[model samples]
Target: MLTLAAGASAPSVATQLVGSGLIGLREGLETGIVVMILVAFLVKSDRRDALKWVWLGVAAAVAMVAIIFVAIHFGTSTVTGLAAELISGLASLVAVVIVTAMILWMRKAAASISGHLRAGLSKALAVGPFAVASMAFFAVGREGVETALLLVGYAENTAGSIWPLVGLLLGIAVAAALTVALYFGAVRINFAAFFRYTGVFLVVVAAGILAYGVRALQIAGWLPGGSNLAFDVSAHFDTSTWYGTVLQGIFNFRPDPTVLQVVAWAVYLVVVLTLFLRPLPAKPGPERAPLPEPSNIPAS
Candidate 1:
C-alpha cells in the first residue's frame, strides 16, 4: 500500500503507465505542433537553410529537459523520510500550478499560437541563424521543462519504478508520429476539440497531484492534521490488489486520507473542472465598415 509515509511498495506498472502516458501525450503533442508550425513556415517560405538551426534548437531543448528530469529524480532519491516527502510535496504543488496554467493559457492561445510562432520565426530569420535556433529553443524548452516537472511529480507515486518512464517515451513517440501525419495532411484533427478534451483530463490529474501534495506535506509536518483521518478503508480496499493499485497510482487515492487532503482534492477538482469545462466566450469578429449611404446621384 502506498501511503504518505515512506517505504510503501511501488504501484503496478499498468497504473503508472497510464498516468505518465497521458501526460506525455498531452505535452508532447503541444510541443510537436509548435515545432511543426515552425518547420512548415520555414519550408513554405523557402527558408529551408534555417531548418538545421531549428533542429539544433530542438536537440538542445530535449537535452535540457533530460538533464532537469534526471537531476530532480535522482536528487530526491538521495533523501529519505521527511526530507523526501517535503521535496516531493513541494514539487507536486509546483507541477500542479504550472500544469494548470498551461491548460488555461493554451485554451485561449491555441488560435493565435501558430501565428505567433511563425511571426517570431520570421523575425528570427531576419536576425540570424543563432536567433532562429534560440527562438525554437526557448519556445520548445518551455513545454519541455513543464513536461519534466510534471513527470517528476507523477514519479513520486511510482515508488521508483522505471515503467512510467517507458510509458512517457511511448507517448512521445506516438505524438511525433501524429505530428508528422498532420504535417503531411495525411490526418485531420480538430485541434480545438482535442485540446479541450485533454484539458479536462489534465485538470483531473492535477487535482490528484494536489491532494497527494497535501498529504505529503501533512506527513512531513509542514501541515497540521496528519492524524485526522477522513476515513480508513485500507483494510477493506486492500491497496496491494490490482484494483487498489490502479486507483492509488492514477489518482493518488489513499484508503485513508487526512481531512485536509480530501478537502483539497474535492475543492480543486470542482473549482478547476467548472472553470475548464465552462463554455468559452465567443471571439469577437472584426467590425465591418458601414456601407456608404444613399448614393442616388452617384451613377450619374
Candidate 2:
C-alpha cells in the first residue's frame, strides 16, 4: 500500500487507468471537434490546397506536446526527497487551475466555436498559407498543452504505472475517429449538451485534483496541521482494495484529511460546480413593433 504518511493508502492501479481515460476522452474530444470544424470549413470552401498547411500546424503542436511530456517525465525522475514532493505538489495545484479554466471556457465558448473557426479560416486564407498554419498551430496547441499539463499532474501520484498513459492514448484514438465521422457528416452531435455534461464531470474531477493539491502541499510542509485528522475511515475503506482505490483516484479521498483541506474541497465544489451548472440566463427576444394608431379621420 502506498502512503504519503505512515498510514495513508495510495490509489490502486485500476483507479489510475479509469481517471486518466476520462481525462483523455474529454480533452481529446474537445480538441478533435475544433479540428473537425476547421477542416470541414476548408473543404466546403473549396480550399483543399491549404489542407497541408493545416496539418503542418497540427504536426507542430503534437511534436511540442510530446517533447514537453518527455521532458517533465525525465526531469522529475532524477529529483529526490522534498524537492520532488514540492514540484509535484505545485504541478497538481496548477493542473487544478488549468482544468477549471478550460471547463469554464468550453462551457461559454462552445456555442460560437464553429463560427469563430470559420471566421478565423476566412481571415487566414486571405493572409496566406503561413497564417493558416499558424492559426491551426495556436488553436490545436492550446488544447494540447492543456491536456499535457493535466496528465503530468496525474502522473506524479501514480509513480511508474503506465495505465494512465495507456488510457489516455486510447481516448485520443477514439476521439480522432469520432472527429472524422463528424467532419464527413456521418454523425451529428448535440454539442451543447455534450459539453455541459462533460463540463460537469471535469468540475468534479478538478475538485478531486484540488484536494490532492491541498494534501500535496501538506506533505511538502507547505500547509499547516498535517497531523490533524478531519476524519478517518481507513478501516471502512482500505485503499489496498479495488473499491478503495476507486474512491482514492476518483475523489482523492483522504481517510484523514486536515480540516483546511476538507474546507477547501467543499468550497471549491460548491462554488465552482454551482456556477458551472447554473443555467445561462435566457437571451431576451426581439421586441415586436407596436401596432400603428388607428387614423381618426381616414380613408373613404
Q: Which candidate tops lDDT?
A: 1
TM-score of each: 0.89, 0.87
- Predicted candidate 2 versus true structure: per-residue lDDT over 104-208, tens digit per residue: 776666655666777888899999999999999989988988888778776665656666787788878877887777665676666666677877877777777
How accurate locally, in lDDT, is each candidate? 0.80, 0.74
Best by TM-score: 1
User: What digit string (tens of lDDT, one per residue) describes model 1 on residues 172-221?
Assistant: 98899888887777777767777888888788778888988998898899
Judge candidate 1 against the unseen true structure and give its global Cα lDDT, from 0 to 1.
0.80
In terms of TM-score, how similar is model 1 to the real structure? 0.89
Error of 2 at 23 (Å): 1.3
Q: Where's the lowest-lDDT run of ten residues in candidate 2?
A: 289-298
- Residue pairs in collision within model 2: none
